[model samples]
Target chain A: MTAAAPTDRTRLRRAHERGHHDRATIDAILDATPQCAVGYTIDGAPYVTPTLHWREGDHVYWHGSSASRALRACDRAEVCLTVSILDGFVLARSGFHHSVNSRSVMLFGTAFKVTDPAEKEARLTAFIDGLFPGRTGMLRPNTEQEIKSTTILGLEIAETSAKVRSGPPKDDEEDYELPIWAGVIPVAMQAGDPIRDTRNRDGVELPAHLRGWRWPG
Target chain B: MTAAAPTDRTRLRRAHERGHHDRATIDAILDATPQCAVGYTIDGAPYVTPTLHWREGDHVYWHGSSASRALRACDRAEVCLTVSILDGFVLARSGFHHSVNSRSVMLFGTAFKVTDPAEKEARLTAFIDGLFPGRTGMLRPNTEQEIKSTTILGLEIAETSAKVRSGPPKDDEEDYELPIWAGVIPVAMQAGDPIRDTRNRDGVELPAHLRGWRWPG
Candidate 1:
């Protein structure tokens, strides 16, 4: 896979060693996490909203109520969508060297509203099935009213950068010798057993796809 | 625990039912998660960056290399700090009703640079000890140069709001009778075994505070 060169805005000014411009690294981080924080401007001040995100090919998409002011502001606006996964906590001997093991991707683009009815519906279904494959086919189709009330926003995955820090702490050369317990407490998002909704139909069973799905998959 | 009235910027324009203005809910969400995305504008374009965050009293703090351009842009600038935790995937009978159980807090304020030398040092120490209590005294003290090379940014926790969604999927009344599997797959950040740094001295052991520290504590 070809790696895209970082634009001036996406370039890492510090800790350039942790910066990754390759699509493989960037796509992996994007695919690993379903939640993302979207940054968009209204008038002039910035607002960050946490929203579920999904990727399809080179475009990333998020949806919300059509009445959402933040979503309306994000339409056609230059937005920054960031997905971050906390991998671990890095403990070091010195306060300055304390860090986190994380993988994050930041994409800069104009968030174009998915106006085509067919495209919006397809993307929304892709999002659902993307997380729970084949589950969409079993679920009731989206009603026309439901589709109308939702606003789907999409951004091309261009001008992107991924930053990752893994393994252990990198303390100053001398601090490594201190009599301190310096290491990492690996952290990951784990999915518990599937919970059946109280209102489920009598014979419904937890589907096979969901049983096989795992967090950070 | 007084609930602050939502400001224009912090108000939840949609789904006000899930909106929380009380300090208890806001603080709980903020404290429950250490990773946050800070949204700030540069040249009127929004930029969101993930960073580790900690709270003290009525303020929140995050620090990074003094040479970071994003940190420099955040200083004295109006910024939005957001923390989000994905609790579960809310699978519903319809794609439109699908949602994620999440707890998120968004705080908006001017990101003030910590200029006081003593305050900076104390806050940095509090951050380390905040996550891992008593670990500061156990480790090598921060050198003067380390302090000089770190830029700490803080924001008062006044203008804040939290949005949380839990429980099973909230599908339409009629849709509940559908044969689809509707439920929540609980998700949480779980910590694995602590991996000690290879360079640790012979007698170093995983400290009590760390072993007892749980993720999402």
Candidate 2:
């Protein structure tokens, strides 16, 4: 497991035990979640926008409208990408110890635009195929105009960390004697039955990917 | 509906139609979700952290460990708080129209620490009772020490906006004839059966609040 070097920005000041700097742990987190929050600053104020993210090897990519102020600012500034999966809520006897069990990743790097058209197309196809193994061939190819209107940014896995907490709550020794129910109430992002579009083409079958979609198993 | 004044910071450069400046819309979105992402800057770099959030009247509050570097920096800096609910995935015939059906709220303001002990305690209790209805009475009250170890930051909804999109995908007139399955796959965050702690006291029954907890309904 190759680990990212601890820079001043990536160091964990609190809960250092739960922090991991290895790429193996970071990749596990990025692969499990499709959504992420991007942090960037404009005129010294910070903004976080939620969007879809995908990974390939040691790179992470996300796209937004070409006119997005956050995206345009981030392309030229330092940014942070964070992805989180809330596993469960930990109920403890003491309010101090009550917390959530989760897996999360934080990465800091400069985001640069993917200017090459060929590279952009490959990444776009990977975004679809990664979620649906063989659905790329079934859809119409993206037009040149459509590609021009979108902005894609890529960041290397240069400085990153993963924090994971699982299992029951850790209450103080004295608090355990209280007659209070304490345990974990597991939470999940569950996919429900698909709602076919009212305008779906006739005789179109439900693709295997959309029928059984899930994240962070 | 009270609307937030549009400063350059709160303006929507892209997807202008989806942006809403009304307080009625912003509060409704904030009241429905339990979590939010906070964006703050340190040494000119931006970081986004995910944590639980609660709203009271015109103010929003989030708590963190007193030792957290992000919270310490945010108490003095300008911050952005964003909440998002991923309702469904929009699958269109052409990739350009593909999007997600979601309701999100973003607020830009300065966060200040709640230094008064009494106000902090009351807000803490409100956080629990807000979700569990009547469950606060069943648990032991918090001690002074537990309160001191936590840091609570409050931000007013002075400059805010709510963005929402729902319904089926909007396919192009020419691409509607393509033989591709297109529609929304409804997504939700759901609670499963609560797992009793291995150290739960004997004879403790699963509380009604825990048994039927739902979000942003």
- What are the per-model DockQ values? 0.87, 0.80
Candidate 2 ranges beyond 4 A from true positions: none
Instruction: Itemize residue pairs with steric clashes in candidate 2.
Output: none
lDDT at position B96, candidate 1: 80
**Judged by lDDT against the true structure, how good is candidate 1?**
0.89
Distance (Å) between predicted and true CA of A118, model 2?
Answer: 1.0
lDDT of 2 by residue, A163-213 (tens): 999989898888777778888878878778888987786789899877677
Q: TM-scores of the models, in the given order?
A: 0.97, 0.97
Q: lDDT tens digits, residues B1-217, model 1?
A: 6888888987877788998999988888888978899999999999998998999989999999898888999999999999998899988888888888999999999999998888899998888887888888887777788788889999999999999888988888999878888889998988989999999889998998798568864
The residue-by-residue lDDT of candidate 1 on A17-45, one tens digit each, is 99999988988999998889999998899
lDDT of each: 0.89, 0.84
